[model samples]
Target: MTLGIDVVRAAPKVLLHDHLDGGLRPQTIAELAAGIGHELPVADPAGLGGWFAEAADSGSLERYLETFEHTVAVMQSAEALTRVARECVEDLAADGVVYAEIRYAPEQHVSAGLTLDEVVAAVQQGFDEASASGGIVVRQLLTAMRHQARSREIAELAVAWRDRGVAGFDIAGAEAGNPPTRHLDAFEYLQRENAHFTIHAGEAFGLPSIWQALQWCGADRLGHGVRIVDDITVHPDGTAELGRLAAYVRDKRIPLEMCPASNVQTGAADSIAEHPIGLLTRLGFRVTVNTDNRLMSNTSMSKEMHALCEAFDYGLADLRWFTINAMKSAFLPFDQRLALINDVIKPGYDKF
Candidate 1:
């Protein structure tokens, strides 16, 4: 059966890759920017929202990333950070996201004199307040800009806050010049401390980026590893072959945090119909759907699932599989993951 958008929105979902900075409400950005005297490209909330979505659809990774200047500018204060973070949880919960790992770079929020630790504390405060009401469980993933030199510091910060709402660490930015291996020291430190991290690779770049992220940095998961499809070839007779890297990824069950809308916006894939997700899912890769940037992509978990259903003719079972895959790949404890799957995700899907 074809799932309607309403049904998809009502289904419980899990998101592994969402950017906190990229998901701010346009109205909130206008308000915060006004408070801080920061001038936006568009003053009207609706216009600003449209501006972000349009500007991000530029088909260039670097150009797409340029939309963040306004969102990041307004988020420099503790009050703004807390408000955005709190609203993020509330919004996700309302959209049927039962679990999520929201990531943002702490260093980016420290420009207004807040320290990295203070920034994390502020964001966590917001998450804790919203999570206290209880429909959703949310955690933070501290990200370090791949073009910067503070990854080791961010990794340590994630470790320090591991017990308090922070789940993992990540590195993200334009992937052309900034390879994941550049932060080897940070990844090594995370490994020694038994911390988890996912690297942004294979989105703008290709197979070598994925190979280096897995083999060199020892990433726990791959962020937008869409280009891994480069290693697989389909024959005219309908047979397919996998290169060593593709075979290893599937064999190891490495989770690919696939963000369809964001991928299309960044020119990672031509369109949803042509996305690599269909082939990867058919071939048994650990594919999990996500909204890499909600404001930028103008998407939510429900919208992403609905799009996949439309494109691949997926039903509730397929949606359930994606949800289960995401939960299994989460940075949460194994026992906790099992409980959510059995008590929350499975039972939730069974009702449909």
Candidate 2:
């Protein structure tokens, strides 16, 4: 059941919770910044990448959140947005990702004079261009920052672009003070329209955050639900028992977009071996692996899968299980999900 990194990289994968702004190539960031006359703390591309990875490992919620300031600062125009979006697809496709849902906050990209719709169009243009020649299937998830009050605006955008390229909606940011309930109107509207949405909960906060996201906001999935690990109890005999919240999550089949490297970098866990995903996956909680921020975490879907396989001694079947879990939880239509799993993922992995 042991696997190598090369074999893992060659295996087909699915990613459900990657951030568009968080996955930019360092060289691309430098080029964009130079064109806009933006000053960067680290001008060299390799050094800049290392800076983000090192800076993100601060383990403090406030400090970790600050790393996005530079990345978002450079991505304020259509050219920067399109280039970042295009590179996101190319990078993931090179890492063997067959399907992915990339999320980004439109409200943050309005510094130079681009409207919310224009930002979406620019990113969509990049994805369409990538899809024309690549083998990867990429979709968009319109994200509204939880600290901001623009969820309704972003939610409506997702609904409007349902037929275009956007697949769903999400609200992400610091989860401690800004709970998902603050965006009740947006969640309510999405629910009424039967539109899909996920909430960022239980990453920096605890069970109360998760309770509000699901019980109050009606989230279809949990973004970084690592804190749900607090509800379960593990005994000396090696047996584990799920608390009420954990039981409900499992019973309802709610997908957990568990990001291993990002969680460790953000202090959600002490290490990957200590990550609750090991036990959560064993207990069957509809768990799926993710690269929360590719730049900050220095990770890819293939690397995430390889890390888990090394940590858990997983093989081809375990990798397949996680890939299928993500594919099932994709916001893409059921027929399309089925086609990718049956036609692409299965056949691709069959070679090894």
Candidate 3:
């Protein structure tokens, strides 16, 4: 027998690909907006969040990115950054997320005359405080905007803060026209320094975008690689065919940070029922469930797992596979990872 949605909600989870800016409390956004005298799309929390989700539905990646203006606007100060980061961890902890890696662009917070280091320090401080209070382990991923030409500086910032709370580097924003390869210099520097980086590819775009990120830029993971399914085919006889890129990705065991609800909202998949998570899981691909943006998608790790369970009939064992896969793909030290597996993950699964 296997536990269902009620049990899954209590199960501990590991989260990757969650953005700090994208996960702010709707109430916090409104409060911050008021403090800064910035006008929001909606005055109320529920309506404000709906506006973000609606604006992000634009098929074009550039258009989808326009919604970030509101999030980034309120995050211009260190105090705001710290408060939001702390609350984000608290919220996840209450929702049963044990470990999480949150990413944000440092450059986006400098409008308040704060240096990049100040921004990183503020968010790290927030994570530290939240961890103390909530007992949740949180790490940071510093991101560089692909359209911006300052990736090298952002990479350096990530490396500088790695000893603190920063865990890795990532490229975000408008992944269609601006591929990860455009930031080759930053990727080369990170590679030379042995830093881990994941790229946003194959989400709103297709396979060519994924190929460029992995083949040219050497990404450690694929952020929203949902569109990599394009490289796969199935014959009338029920035999699956894998194209070269798909085969390479599968063989390499590169993690796919799949955000099911976000994928549907962005048209990456037709619906959660038809999502390739079920297909890829059966094929042994390293698939991890994530809530790309809790506010924008109105989701959490629990909701994502519940959705998968209902959509694919996943049970306790299947949920265990997702958790272990996420732990394996997490950018944590070997000892800590094993400890989490043995101490936290296994015990939670047993209870379910």
Candidate 4:
């Protein structure tokens, strides 16, 4: 039987595409804004959370991104970064996320007196302190703004800190005109160094964007690869046809970091009921659920799973499948991934 939302909430989860600045607690944001003498559209924490969700609900992708300006405004200092990072782990632990890879661009945080290295150090310290509570493994993905010209620097930063706590590199920001091919040099550098990287593609764009990321830049995973559904056509007789690109993605077993709610808000999908994650997951295309922006979407891992359960009739067993898929696709070493599966994820789900 499909259990209730309570069981879904209690299930151990893995998060792969959450953003650090976008996941801050509303109260933390308010406090940080005040401490920095910055202004917010809403001052009260509860009101501010609602405001973020409402603002992000705008149907335009460009308009949806504007909500980040406030969150990024308060995160320019080391103290603010550490506090947000620590609270991020604590909140994820409370929400039953046993493992997560939180990504943030270091370039966005250097406007204050801190250097790029100082920013990473502060966030790492926060994750370390929060992990002391146990039952949570948090890693970092140093992201570069794709619309900017610093991807090579960010990729090098990821490689330099691979032995420390940084797990991999990623390219984020708008995807309209800034195609992944623009950063081919950075991707090629990571390839030569044998480093891992995922590119944000096929979200606001279409299949050509995804092809460039995978075929041109060699991405390990597709961030918000929701638009790949464009290549799939469902017939009236309930049969489906897969385009060459979709077939290649499935045959290659490429992971799609699908964020359902965020897709709806950003106009990638019509709604959760009609979201492509259901089709992709059922088709065995290496689907993984994620919360792209917890604060903006007002979501958690449990919330995302519960929504999918209601949307797709997913049960405990089905939820376990998604959890394990995310774990397998994680950038963590094989030993670490298997240990988490054996000791944490499987046991946690088996109990339910």
The lDDT for every candidate, in the order shown, is: 0.94, 0.90, 0.89, 0.91
Rank the models by lDDT, top first.
1, 4, 2, 3
The true-versus-predicted C-alpha distance at residue 34 of model 1, in Å, is 0.6
Give me the runs in candidate 4 sitting further than 4 Å from their true place: none
User: Model 3: residues >4 Å from true position, as ranges?
Assistant: 1-4, 57-64
List TM-score per model, in order. 0.98, 0.98, 0.95, 0.98
Each model's number of backbone clashes? 0, 0, 0, 0
Cα shift from native, residue 143, model 1 (Å): 0.6
Tens digits of per-residue lDDT for model 4 on 73-114?
999988889999999999999999999999999999998778
Q: Return model 3's CA RMSD, one decimal.
A: 1.8
Judging by TM-score against the true structure, name the best candidate.
Answer: 1
In angstroms, the error of model 4 at 101 is 0.4
lDDT of 3 by residue, 268-301 (tens): 8988999989888887899999999887787899
83 in model 2: Cα distance from truth in Å? Answer: 0.8
CA displacement after TM-score superposition, residue 109 of candidate 1 (Å): 0.7
Give the number of the best model, judged by lDDT. Answer: 1
TM-score of 4: 0.98
